[model samples]
Target: MRIPKLASVFLLMACLVAYLTYVKWHIEGIKPALFKVPYQHSGTESDDDKQTSPDLSSDRFQYGIMFDAGSTGTRIHIFKFLLEENEPPKLSHETFKAIKPGLSAYADDPDKCREGIEELMEVAKGTVPESLWNSTPLVLKATAGLRLLPGEKATQLLDKVREVFEESPFLAKGDSVSIMDGTDEGISAWITVNFLIGELNDSDGATVGMLDLGGGSTQITFSPQDKTIQTSPIDYITSLQMFNRTHTLYSHSYLGLGLMSARLAILGGVEGQPLGGSQELVSPCLSPDFEDRWEHAEVVYTVKGQKAGEPVYESCYNKVEKVLYRKVKKAEEAKEMNFYASSYYYDRAVDIGAIDENIGGVIKVNDYSEAAKKVCNSIVETPQEHPFLCLDLTYISVLLQELGFPKDNVLKLARQINHVETSWALGATFHYIESLSRQQMTEHTGKEDKMAALSAQ
Candidate 1:
């Protein structure tokens, strides 16, 4: 809303002042290149995990809504920020909710995606106060799952979401609903890790690397040590600007190298194309005579194992090697960085008692190998709780080695840092809000100048 002449100048000044305050809150973290998920949810909780709200007034707070549309499921994050202070904004309260059968599930029936999208919106409406609904930005970012779909199908799905977003009370930008680029995904994940670790606030502190294993893709990102950098591919290096400082990060996302996709490949089944009929997919990765059913990318396959003979770990390793060999680029620099691995890495580590679910733990590269050997050995004697456990452990060990991490090198794995869950969404929120602020300033300048001239006359 604009006021007459003199008032417009004051409004412009106000916008400028507001933008300056937000800069100290946002620029300390991620920049927009600048960048997807499993659905996990809980009720409203403060920074202390209690139901109590801060003493801040409603007008003094800002909120952001992010929908992580992943292959396996969809999740919504409603975040509230305390913005009245001159210092960096504190994440005061958050509400999260998730639903299965991601948007990609309705590829053929795109419009059917409405029910789920609207359901998530209901959560946002309840979490974000109505007064701030129009000010809060709503965004949905699809990841590898959507990218793997046919061009026309992906476009259709995104269009369907755009329609829902348009009707919501929250602010929606032109690119609000779309498939996120893989490279940006890695960079954003890297930002999430550093931000959570407080590395972004300390200009001179060393930051960490990030390893994210999703159902459709995997990403690796970090700031490489100058001398440790090798002849990496040109596309693997990208420059990021934060706090007005340039950071050249080693980053990449392998579309098909994710744990789920790799498992599907190891089982000898194609992604969209299932075995034409009753043909069962067989592999040495499973226990001898082991028979089971598994579903991937909406296709169900009958999978089993080879006859028991050689050591189970060795047999599984052979299969895992073929799936990963020469596929992952080795980064010598990753070994020197303190890497934080999450997603399936954290899940599998918990499954094997290597890490506690709540606190997580540290492990050397060989820890995977040891876990794989132990698990694989027992699976041969009896039916294991998780049939894919052997293959997963073996695959992770080999994949790490392929990426140039030696057996002795250590990595810290976690699902969260402090009380808040670790995720790329936090980093992305800052980027989105900052972009929105810049757009407003640009639009404000011309209008303000025109009004100032009219006032003088």
Candidate 2:
């Protein structure tokens, strides 16, 4: 009751300072600690660690898995992408694994296909973080091999793959597993090559064409300088819209024109047809003295070379011409376009030392023809190490010419571009992501419209 006024005022000011200090500690320190506790218990990193660590959210790395089901093999591609807002995603890493004998081999026993699919799924599961398992998309696109199978059998195998996909944690849309149309196969491959080379999105960038040879089909796709729709067959032209631009590409896939299928055809063996009892397929394309058993589509055929008469190249050329002549429509526009030939095209070129396996190289259409003649002529004198080499080389030579590549027209043979396999899977994945984004945008716009209408009301 007898306290001085100055001392009382000092005590009051000191209490106010203490109250403000407590409030600051609660708001800036204790609240952050409480929020951070959950992240620590959730087993994620602390806030400080997250700030320093690699960003794993929407703005950074994402992944997609694609399965390529071909006639000879099933391959899985686990692609890791670096995403930036308003920019195209960049492929950072790719994990590719392949299992042999293809999914089509299990057509009769559809249940057996599950093991291979599950094995490939494990690769995807390992590549993508567990946190993103539910969000990552998984897709399988079967090509000519499955397309050639009986409808009932192909359906059974696809159904089993769908079941396996459903059991996995990844996002599996209803249309994720299906047979890819041959035209789409060509277009997807074109997208992959052009995208990898940075031409797909660039308005002024020059685009190269693609030639992909699989086991049961071969595809040629290119954008013509002159609109092909005016002169080319309507069936050969495909219009694709990408990156806000429409590309009228001359794209076609030749069924039964692939190396293996062509071999059977050249040998006069019909696809899906069994030979007469104990009969052998004799062909001039083989070495005169050679005889062996060849296996295709789970059936064994006795194959032998015909007796030597004229020069090997001359006779072999005649037989190969029968398979190529008038069988594939020639694209006059392809004569002017640069093409990147891959898949079996690369394999065959590398086999005969026409191109380097690692660095890749370019060769003229006549290079194949010359190589064929050399191989064919030599096989008769000295038995060839590979019986099919002569035939394969001849087929490729004649096939290119039939497709309208002149003798001097050059083609680039490569197995990979920018450390990624030159295949359609990458392009298909890009298409899938774009489709998803477009769908999400449409839904978002619809929602916004509804909200705006309500506000106006």
Candidate 3:
């Protein structure tokens, strides 16, 4: 084959070019498929979430952002999670920031609420890595504060928040910004506390109960061993699934029973309805000599103490009783379960020095009684910033009794568990992320393609 050396060289060159092209195609196409065979993950997690989690061999990290729109404040919770095979997602880190005067405060001017929402978005952007922004679920669940607003005003406020969320880089759905049912709020908070306390890992173990008192409403949630526990009002019982197990919880949220709302009730003020001109709210809960204007949900009312020498504690207790009687269903099972109290429950306990600021302590139901009695009888000569302390403690005392806690029943109060804030935000975050995973499954499934083809016919 020593014909022309130039012809032989050309022949060799053509063969080499063909082999390189074949190699390129094999590496780009077939090699990927070798490693891409659908990997099966082991777990009892619903099939919808089976593929939502990243591979354990890789970075294996996820993030969730939740905004707790409560009556008193708007808080942003940025959470980082580490995914593991066949186990629950672990919360590795959390970033929390709160701004006062919730969205309802801007009911008259919804546009002004954008500034606070944007500021919180900045915090979220800074906390989460840029690459994960688009994948992270962003949600805002407004609680009792928004629920207390007029229908038109609530819609307007929610619309404003939705506009802001859509503009951000994070993942948000159509229902991202909305009012959360009070019972769901209690259930989410119950999930958070139980998960933080390591109770969710054991299916047979009794999960601790949750008591959350916010500015606009209060929630009580617990899981009783006996299935026959009757939750009067029928709607108070709810079933929630977490980590593949279903929990039957007796949870209720009293709309006007929240600390701030209760203060309004105890002072004889109506919710969402402003007091008319020159109308005054007088109560024995306040100091006999004190007079002031109190503002709640953007409405200001003239509030003051009752006349001097009227048994302050007794009168306050009777008034609180009126507000609570027949309003809250008594849960007899709370006496047997360990419970954790959060929100205003923690704040009031701290105010009275019943629990240390740094290390929260356990207190009996009567502790609130003792503190309320003392706060009511004495007058603080200084600038009484929280004149409602007496009313709050007393209402808590009566509320506990109405909820079936004996005077001597001890309850644990904490603002955080294991360095994580003991609020519904975390539990809600995990739940939201799982929902996103389910949505993704529905979107990417081969069945969708089949359905599209069938519809075309």
Candidate 4:
């Protein structure tokens, strides 16, 4: 049947709109064509992303939200731009808010999903920049905690989170909720950290290795050059597959190193070891109440000697902070302590009992010496590498020599990493501008344009 070209075009447009509406309401939260798909950029932006983006300069938003869901807590970094006359771009203004209700808190309670967003908002109270209050572009995201939700649960949780975002009062016109899984979380962290530390080698390079230590799980990503790993369970949009031509990246999420795991590991190991018979030689790090088990109350104890186990538990207001400082001060000794000994081996002083100045008497040190000694020995025999290492400009030069990478290639990699660092701050600004441009088009014409106008002032 002969049909007018206008009529046929109209029919096609109607079909397209119907499909889009169906996608938006019934299937996924948003259409892949209109929104960034989950895991789509798992390794890096796809060909379509590159093809669609035309303008990469001059954005409109002033503030950006960078959410980092760590092992013990979830941190939200709010950043704002400051315009200066003929000045180089920089992350001039920023703030951070964190919530301790980590992934474990929402493991069973689906309602707790919104807690992540709420916590960030509550903490930002008066701190939110005045400019961002009405039109700020909030980038909502998740990390290790929600990365591994089972099956459709992640989708439902993400949907619920989106629903909360729509209902949230803090949301601005262009605010968005992007739920991410382990791969994306780990990669983004790697990218963000290296960008901050000046490690990304180049604008077109690709590198991947991650060791992320989260609360319940550790995510390890090994994105080989020109290859992608299929570990992420979420659709492509939720994954953070980074693809660059000239950068170096490695990341991993180790689950057991968080505060909770570390404490448990220490406690369990200490339980098996027997204390020594020494009195007044107690370890200074342990508290007198080390042996007590109260489900809800704080444990208290005192260490007995100098360099000996002191009443560390009783002296500190919080056990975590005390342990953190102790850990850093003792980090050099980490290689000597095994996972088992890490629980109780503060020092040999703990083997000796503490002195009771009030009673003029010496206390006995119940030494778990043998067990601690065993664990310490293991640490020495097997050293743990840094969770992830950066192949910075200098590192790349050295690594290339060791691997016999052509001198030319070495120089190229070095140059790329240097360039990325130089442009790191601007890259983020460009990304934000691009996002704003797309949103404006969608709002006005119902046409989602991938290209965004971004420029530096």
For residues 13-123, what per-residue lDDT tens digits would candidate 4 score against the true structure? 776667557534532211111111111121223456446544323232245555554435666666544322222223333455667865435656667767676767665
- Worst window of 10 by summed lDDT in candidate 3: 30-39
> For model 4, what is the C-alpha lDDT against the true structure?
0.36
TM-score of each: 0.83, 0.84, 0.80, 0.39
Give the winner by lDDT: 2
Report the error of model 2 at residue 247, Å. Answer: 2.6
User: So what's the TM-score on candidate 3?
Assistant: 0.80
Candidate with top TM-score is 2
The full ranking of all candidates by TM-score, starting with the best, is 2, 1, 3, 4
Clashing pairs in 3: none
Scored by CA lDDT, what does every candidate get? 0.79, 0.80, 0.79, 0.36
Query: lDDT (0-100) at residue 44 of candidate 1?
Result: 62
User: Compared to the true structure, candidate 4 yields what TM-score?
Assistant: 0.39
Compose the digit string of candidate 1's lDDT tens values, residues 20-102.
Answer: 56654554322222100112235764354432444545766678899999887899988776654334444655688899988
- What lDDT tens digits, residue by residue, belong to model 2 across residues 1-457? 5568888878766765675565444333211000111111111224564464354554255678999998888998887666544456566567788998798888778999999999988878876789888878889999877998899999999999999999999999998899998878888889888987879878898899999887788989999866566888888877876644678888888888988889999898988886889658999999889999999776799999989899878888898997787889888888988999987778878888988889899988898888888898898789778898889988998888899899999998776777667789988887776666556556655765665465446
Clashes of each: 1, 0, 0, 90
lDDT of 1 at 66: 90
